[model samples]
Target chain A: MTAPAYNKPLLDVRGLTIEIETRRGPAVIVDGINLTVGKGETVGVVGESGCGKSLTMLSLVRLLPNKIKVRGGTAVFDGRDLLQMSKSELRQVRGGKIGFVFQDPMTSLNPVMRIGDQLCEPLIYHRDMKKADARKRAIELLKLVGIPGPEQRIDAYPHELSGGMRQRVMIAIGLACDPELLIADEPTTALDVTIQAQIVDLVKELRRKLGMSVVWITHDLALIAGLVDRVAVLYAGTVVEDAPVGELFKRPTHPYTRGLLASIPKLSDERASRLSSIGGTPPEPGRRPKGCPFAPRCGLAEPICHEHVPALLSFAEEPRHRVACFVAQRQMMEAA
Target chain B: MAPANLTAFVDEDPPVSLWRDAWHRLFRNKLAVAGLVIVIFLALVAMFGPWLTPYDFLTQNLEVRNQAPSLAHLFGTDDLGRDVLSRVIYGTRTAFVVAIVVTTVAVAIGVALGAIAGYYGGLLDRTIMWFTDMTMSVPNLLLVVVINASLKTPVTAWMEAQYQATLNPFYRQTVWVDFLLVFGSMALISWPPYARLVRAQVLSIRGRPYVTAARALGLTNRLIIMRYIVPNAVGPLIVSVSAGLGTAMVLESAFSFLGVGVNPPTPSWGNMISDGLRVWQHYPHLLAAPAAVLGLATVAFSFLGDGLNDALNPRGSK
Candidate 1:
């Protein structure tokens, strides 16, 4: 693992917590989390469904319903705390500075509106440009995203375009304002492998061209491998481990991270038995273990691991590579 | 551009307009087309009925009162000897006007209230809905009847005053007062349901992902409603307007039949039915013709409305 000196973090989130008031009581969905995305760097957040990864990104935009509230946290992006911003103020930051490419391209786009009108809405609202200019920019964007006949495609509806084309259009819309940061939540998950690769490559190319920071939220470890600089592994609404991509994959300190890594099919392995699946269902919201949230299913869990929650301890006096497990930390230092 | 990709050129299809799609689907429904034709014909008759007929709708002759169907007066005559065919023709004008005005007003109020209530939840939604609920709680027909009844005494007094001044038979009648009762009362009663329908529809659509995308794009609430919310919610609105028109016509006709809509000396289909029913055995043709017009008009409007509802919503396609 190497430390590439960051210019400056475009987004720095610290002590972020999210909770929803249920009939039972206030259920914590996202535990205290800290992360940062350097200007122009891509940080991949990988986790299974219900891992609170989606909530983390959504909370940054303050898009979650009123039922879900940020219990405590500060999301400082470009000198402003996003949590403190009002609805109107947040709107300026949301699409203007921080672009979001949602998962379902079909649903994300208005089915009734033309591609041109949809693409130009952001320029009109945030940039306050003239319609003609917005339309011109939109055509350019569609072309940039590899859509052919940009002029004609601009007037097409969401259903008329293929899934890949729709996704490209979504990317164009997201990058319309040249946002400082792009939060892509499973942007390629719904697509086929070739199309997924195309989207990934397109994102990477766009990042290079625009030098924009991106938080690529996905469940695929393989997709995150070559794309992201750092990786954050989440389980049961908490980040189990956070480290540089190579280090996390090479020497995963968290058992859940290890299981997730091992779950990826390797080319060399030849086995008669079925491919490994993470045993047991993920712990539901309120029923989360009081100590280490992963202790119940973790085979490495000791008595102490069940008694108290382990702080995200460093692997070897190194602050950058951290894991939330006392047993895992001790094992790591001993091996070192 | 070297050999502009032929497949790519073909793929870039234009988005279909919602109005165009609605029109396309409407054409597919033959019954709706037939209904539209009837409604148009009825509208034309209403607009030009006065010019087409010689006998004034209000003119009455006690000497020739309650005549049966004859060669000269096609549909025969009412109790006052005012031609039933003439009155029914002019009544088309009243029905068309009342239906158009009341439906337009109702839909305007309903769509506004519904969109606001749906788009903005919590207290705003509840308050608007509570008002809708209060309106819906009253039996619509009974409420309109009471409202109409309250206006009658003043109207009767006004009619007496007009009769005293002009001494013309038609001026002494209750025609103008009845028109006011039908238009005003129905408009007041019809708006609540449409508001409720729009509110329910908006509530569901406002939370959809596209709406979220629109907000994320920093679209103003007004622009979002106008461009996104209204267009999506229009299928229900079209249905409401169509059915609402039919309902308004029936309400007006009922009031006229009750002698509270347009009074004696002046003739309407409902008033003719009221006057003819008394001498049913002798002059059955007088009641039959107006009744036929009312039934046919209602059925035509309903078919048109059903067709419109089917055609306007593309998602309605299986």
Candidate 2:
């Protein structure tokens, strides 16, 4: 009775299936994906293009395009199913309890509107504050986001601001209501390396300061390596492997995860044969492999691996370290 | 809350209210400004035209009939010996009244219907649009004539019957009846285009992200349409409204020129010119003055509308 056996995860996504009604048929984009983020924990999702990582995050907030529909899922956030929430209810949760930072800062902010008005919009909508109060809060948020001279910048339009400044404004808008969870979808992907690092640091610093859970979705592994506590590796439309940050990097269990790690250039390696790139591009939506999505690129692929789909299997050595591969464990055993 | 001192952080273009910006742009268009000035001047002339004139528009003078323009009569005497200048000035008041009233009502009816149809976008949109199309299908000239003829039949018949009983032919020939006929007919035929224009504009603005953002904020649909949709769509509506004003004025004059517009003795520019054409060999001033004013009014309105379109565009500003 002295201590509780376990703590519930902040965002528990289980068996989430997303299908897009294509010209062909309902093609599954996010197939049977499951993951968790503990309270104040940062979970980084990394995958190549069209691997359903961004779609998976968008699905959580019910922000997917009209064609891509959710088939089956339980995005249990603060004891509520996001998939089942009414449009109005979903809106209340979105930008209120769960903030979203989109990738393209250029298109995200309204071109015609002043930055202050855009920031104040949510406050007036969700908080029911007076216009003056809303504006004051917006100024405070602008200042918090490190926008210079919040007083004058509030009246400026989106076009007047630089790229870095605009992204900062996007983050400020995301953190407007002091949300419990932040879903940042490739927030810094459009920016330069130095600016990307700055944004990553800002997010990490904000998470530490506010004690809010973050699901940072990105294609850049190195960026996530420094910021996130855990890593969820996605392939095609599913999470191939998930483990604590250190364990996933030290011993990547899935072939896709190993391929992703190998692709990254190391400072110690010679320039000639330094990086090992993943062969073949991600599969198109409708034409997916019968067995495993990543089996075509797997070096240890066998007849069984090609014939049967890999289930997310736990290892005896580290139960938390889950990998969806038939031959990864056997290969590890044989090598030892 | 205490009145908080609001300040802009970035020193850029001095912060001005949205309406102020619209006004500035509207005023800057040279043609629109000129048109506005002409309209204002015409409005003043129309208002004070009667007080400035000695003879009434309908007063008949057999002795001074068919006289040339001179300082004594100034604009000369008509067939009834009324001063041409006085009659012309008085007629302007009628044109201004009809143009202003028709344009206002048309914009009001059109904008309301258009906003509702475009924003809702279902059965209401289809029904309103269908009615507009049906209205538009009728030739504008035929529509105006039909409205005028319907109004005239009962009144003309009643007056003719009274004249026959009283043995008096003079009472039926009057200008007041003609002004009423023109005003009512022009208004009826001119409103459909405005309604259709507003609907199209509303449809475009409704698709914008700000409008969607307003909805997501949980603002009531009515408020969202009124506050955001209508305001954003005003840029187009304003241009339409200005252009419609000019079109309606021309339509009113065209109706008059057809003898169904303003009646004889009222001295409306259209009928005045029409009358001058009948006896152009003898009286040229009647045609020249009215034609000049009519042309000037049309040009002014067109210029103003064009100017407004340019001014309201923030990107258009230097």
Candidate 3:
């Protein structure tokens, strides 16, 4: 695949390192990560749980949990550095230019607030719309999210709705201001499979209609295969491979990414066959291996794999397909 | 399901807000309902006690002095010939006033300080908590007694001076001095619990995902606190206030019985009970009248508070 060159990306994050305070001392959770989402692009951030996928997205908006600090990062959105922006400036950017849909819709929404009020909150605050106008927009937003009888549903509390409906409301709230980018962090994890497909389709349809960039964070690669334009596979708080969706599936160069892709049970697999899975778990935050975080789990590990961390390098043929693995790079070089 | 049928189950009844939901839960609890009814009845009686009382509580009928329960006087007459029933009704008024005033002042101060401390933790939280701890460390009765004893004389003298200088009837009203001392001292002691309750509430609520969602919406801190945090935090506060009202009434009665509460002629239950105690062996009616009513009020408030706590926090119950 030919690389789309010369255009500046919409959001460029470089050397993003996030740390958490522990009893002994501070430990790195996200270690000098680099990522980019282009204009009108839908990028899937696929990772296992605790791979810092959610943390990376949250830190872009300076919404990291207490005692977890962003040690170093430059997240350039539009033209300004998001990390360096003042509080008021950041406020203008959040829910105005950038939207967020959290994982658990059940707890993420305010239970006491009516759906209408929650929908209108951003409109009133960020857009400075009148109450009546915001109410009208809220109903329209409810309709936009395919909620039945939006006029009546607007008055319902969060508890009154089913999980899928609540997630749709959450998405409506995220899209209330017609933001330039939407950061959805596992928005479908808590939902059932069919409902998850519906949400994905809804997001895809909405993105097509609105032309907004989306950073879809999820642990399910198969779920986002047809939805995202590109995929960034995260393993142990670092991006191991990033490529166009088709290319990533065709050539998963990183051992971690390959293992993740292989783990997704395919329809052609024999019913009685054992599902393939990578041995060993991701290292704990404070006790991570010195060289490569994935080396201990990589079947292709050599003596040097434990001595030096592999830097993310682009494939010689396709510049857009980047991979971080010493063995993979050496094999490709030997093959050439 | 089709879109129409999808909402059918949820749409059968009108949507209920959180407050209405809580109210519904409260009404279902029979003990809470009974308590609520009694509290309302007492409050109404207190409001209209003067007009409703058959005889003046203070108007002495010398012929009826030391009488037992009789047809004309329901609760009989006291040693001073005052109607025991009328005095008990007036005592209700005193209890209600002190409870309402002290609790209101305490809640307001507590909510403000607690919200600030909880929202902005660090030196401010430490300082406010330190101050709260210091105030709580002092014995409540001792603090009130000290305040009243030390401040009452000078305040009364100042009121007298002002009455002489300005000839204002308001200044001449010495009962105002008693009320000011009682309210001020009680409010000072009453606030710490409320402050602690609210602080703990705010601390827990601050970490809730909805609050974080609110911040993500670019809402100002003030809006988030008022709209998100405070509304959620207020459920426990309501239960506390319900219980605190009863506690305040008892505290007032105790202080008055000890001669530090509202002075004589106000017909406070505490003072009335104190007076009745002197001749209780001869006339048990005197002691029983005021004591029974006070006990009833305390029990009613406690039941109501317990009901509210259970209703507001349904998850805590089975």
Against the true structure, whose lDDT is highest? 3
lDDT of 2 at A7: 67
Candidate 3 clash pair list:
none
The numbered model that scores best in DockQ is 3
Better-scoring candidate (DockQ), 1 or 2: 1
Chain A TM-score by candidate, in order:
0.96, 0.94, 0.97
> Compared to the true structure, candidate 2 yields what TM-score?
0.77
Against the true structure, whose TM-score is highest?
Answer: 3
Candidate 3 local lDDT, A144-222, one digit each (tens) = 8888888889999999899999999999999999999999999999999988988999898898889889999999999
* TM match of model 1 to true structure: 0.90
Give the Å shift of residue A308 in candidate 1. Answer: 2.3
The local distance difference test score of each candidate is: 0.83, 0.78, 0.91
- TM-score ranking, high to low: 3, 1, 2
Model 2: runs farther than 4 Å from truth? A1-6, A61-63, A262-279, A296-300, A329-336, B1-138, B144-237, B256-281, B307-318
Please give the RMSD to the true structure for each candidate, in Å.
3.8, 6.3, 2.1
Sort by lDDT, top down from the best: 3, 1, 2
